[model samples]
Target: MEMNLDSVKVVGFDADDTLWVNETYFRETEERFAELLESFETKNKIDQELFKVEMQNLDLYGYGVKGFILSMIECALQLSNHTISNDTLQEILDVGKKMIAHPVELLSGVEEVLQKLENKYRLIVLTKGDLLDQERKLEKSGLSKYFHHVEVLSEKKEENYQNLLEHLEIDVNEFLMVGNSLKSDVIPILNIGAKAVHVPFHTTWAHELVSKEKEKSTNGYLKLESIKDILDYLKH
Candidate 1:
């Protein structure tokens, strides 16, 4: 674990899993959704079809409800042969939207750590999703008060991070990105010469999974089993 508190001033977090439980709710909703499609298509087929559309919608719709809605729409039309009624589609849409307003709970020690770090570090939240949904979740979580800035990103690419670093007036290496999802939060930032601390979540999201690990990174990349481990890393 490589960390130097002096080298970092702005600590940006990848919301969702880092600050609160996000994937568990998404998983529960997806399980029920998968059940709904079982009669129309096999689980394997349904997953395959949905993933195909999600790949295309990544840029067009982005993450959160918009992407989930597009995925469900594509899934319904594919499974139902373009015959699925609007009512059923609406139900899925409702579910996707509802996910945002769902009660957001912090993983154990998240509030404590944030409270401890906020006084010393300029903490900000960097999340990719529907802006409104992200804000609502942050507000509902009661953790919004602690952050100095909140960036709701459309995508988590190398450029998005580079732009953020420039806009925030900070060097890539000066910012420490703490979050889950190696593909989104770790890899791209590392590409830009930034330091990233990966806090692995217990329940990872389906879309967030990179499904592969590539070559080793030259940038400092530290991985932790849980968010609480962050305290130890920061203390040193």
Candidate 2:
């Protein structure tokens, strides 16, 4: 599906892997905890515990730093010899406050592409996470100016995307969804009849890397290697 650039009024972007480095920080924290718990449990066992806790918490807690914090606590308890108190749990949870990743480095030409397209499209950042944390990363990366609005939500389902477009009084066909995850970003937008662009990120979030791309839902979706490729497609 090709688009006339000027006709596209709203361009929604996903956070995390799409705009900056997200999963690496969580991976780093998990590795640190594995080392700390290595004596109590084998590395394989620790990884298994983390995966189980995280899977369980995704249902109870949804996704974000809070879920990650809970996963760490669960891992600690499952492998610990002594009883864990609330204070001990708080100690584990507090790590999230300092869990900010290194810096925001764009995937190749993300910033440049955003800069080029900002004037033509109504740029909106639709990301999910702790609001303050997302804001800090955006500010630190010097990427806040290009966007007109920033929305941080818990999930990016069909209802959420549809509501945003309805409120903006924009037709679904006139808007586009651009992001990394084929699950969260591509499939849902397409389900809503909006144009979806799949920009693959190198290191995706563990839960967000979907294995269902071949399904009929995303058959005609536009897939690009990176954000920069969107520019070339646009000029066509």
Candidate 3:
């Protein structure tokens, strides 16, 4: 679908995989988690069980490393039939700690795009996760200077986007969101009468994935090969 770039005034960027390396750490942690449970179950089964527990605990823990750490521990207990050792459990917690301490690695062209667009548009950050964790990453990223506002929503539904736009006093038609997840970044923004740009990361968390049919049905958003490609249309 064609984008009305001329009408775009405010640009919202998603944190995590869109601007920096995020999912890679999660994937690595998952691998470590599976390895810790290999004695109790196969890697595949461990992965599935962990994901199941994570989904079940979504509302209880929301999202981010803390929840994921808890889910991994719960999954280990379930897979091992409560026989998992304390050492293995400690390893699982360490996995999450490492993830939290990991340095932010910005994606290719992230700084260049932000630098070019900083003066031309009112840039903001719109991401959902543990508020402290997200804020910490933003501070570490050194990209905070470019953003006029940063919001860490509990969820990224249409209403969430609508409410944020209203709170910020930004017209829906004049706001454009750019991010890596179609589910979190593109679809909701489109549904809320705003524009979005989808620049997919190589690895997506299972929860952030949208069905092929849903993706195909969604329209009115731009899909770019890289965040840098956005410049061609946004004209920063």
Candidate 4:
């Protein structure tokens, strides 16, 4: 891992898997969704189709549980050829409601790391999702007080990050982003001359996967087994 934390002033954390348990809930809900629509299609087929539906709807619904629920509904309709009953649709809606109401489970060592770095560097959340949903999670997390700012972005592209850095009055090299997804959290920030640390989550969304070749070419960023380990890299 090659890193120069000497210039880093603002340390931005990714909210989802980096700091808490998020993708697991989505995976569990997906399994339930597959079971619900088993009569229409096989679990494998349903899973693949749900991903396709999500990709197609990304532009329309953006990212979050609400968009996920809508994608599930669309997938159910298509797989059933529009024959899926209203009751099933209600069940899908309930799944989303339950997810939205799910408690915020912070990953291990999250607080300890935050406490160690809170005063040393400016901490901010750089996550992408529905604004309301993100805010709700932040409130439930009880980690909001440690952060200097919270940004719920619609997308995690180079331009979005550029704008954020500009607004914060920080140079690209002075900002470091920590997150789970390389495609979303690492690559874009790296592209804009910022530093990024990849803290891998066991279960990643398919959309967040990057090609091996692409990953190999994107050097200079640190890849740690856990978010807690970031303290070792920056604290030294």
Evaluate residue 169 in candidate 3 and report its C-alpha lDDT on the 0 to 100 scale: 100
lDDT of 4 by residue, 38-143 (tens): 9989999999999999999999999999999999999999999999999999999999999999999999999899999998999999998999999999999999
RMSD of 1: 2.2
Ranking by TM-score: 3, 4, 1, 2
Tens-digit lDDT track for model 1 on 104-195? Answer: 88888888889888888889999988898898889888998999999998889999999988998987767889888888999898889888
Off by over 4 Å in 1: 211-219
Q: For candidate 3, write residues 1-236 as lDDT tens digits.
A: 56669999999999989999999999989888888888888999888888999999999999898998999988988999999999888888888999999999989999999999998999999998999999999999999999999999999999999988999999998999999999999998988888999999999999999999998898888999899999988867
Best by lDDT: 4
Q: Model 2: per-residue lDDT, tens digit, 79-189?
A: 885565676566566666567545676667879988888887788898887777788888987889999888887788999988878887878877888888888888888
C-alpha-based local distance difference test score of model 1: 0.81
Off by over 4 Å in 4: none
- Candidate 2 residue 1 Cα shift, in angstroms, is 8.6
Q: Which stretches of candidate 2 lie over 4 Å from their true place?
A: 1-7, 81-95, 212-217
Residue range with the least summed lDDT across 10 consecutive positions in model 4: 227-236
Which 10 successive residues of model 3 have the least lDDT summed? 1-10
Clashing pairs in model 4? none
What TM-score number comes out for model 3? 0.98
Local distance difference test, each candidate: 0.81, 0.78, 0.92, 0.93
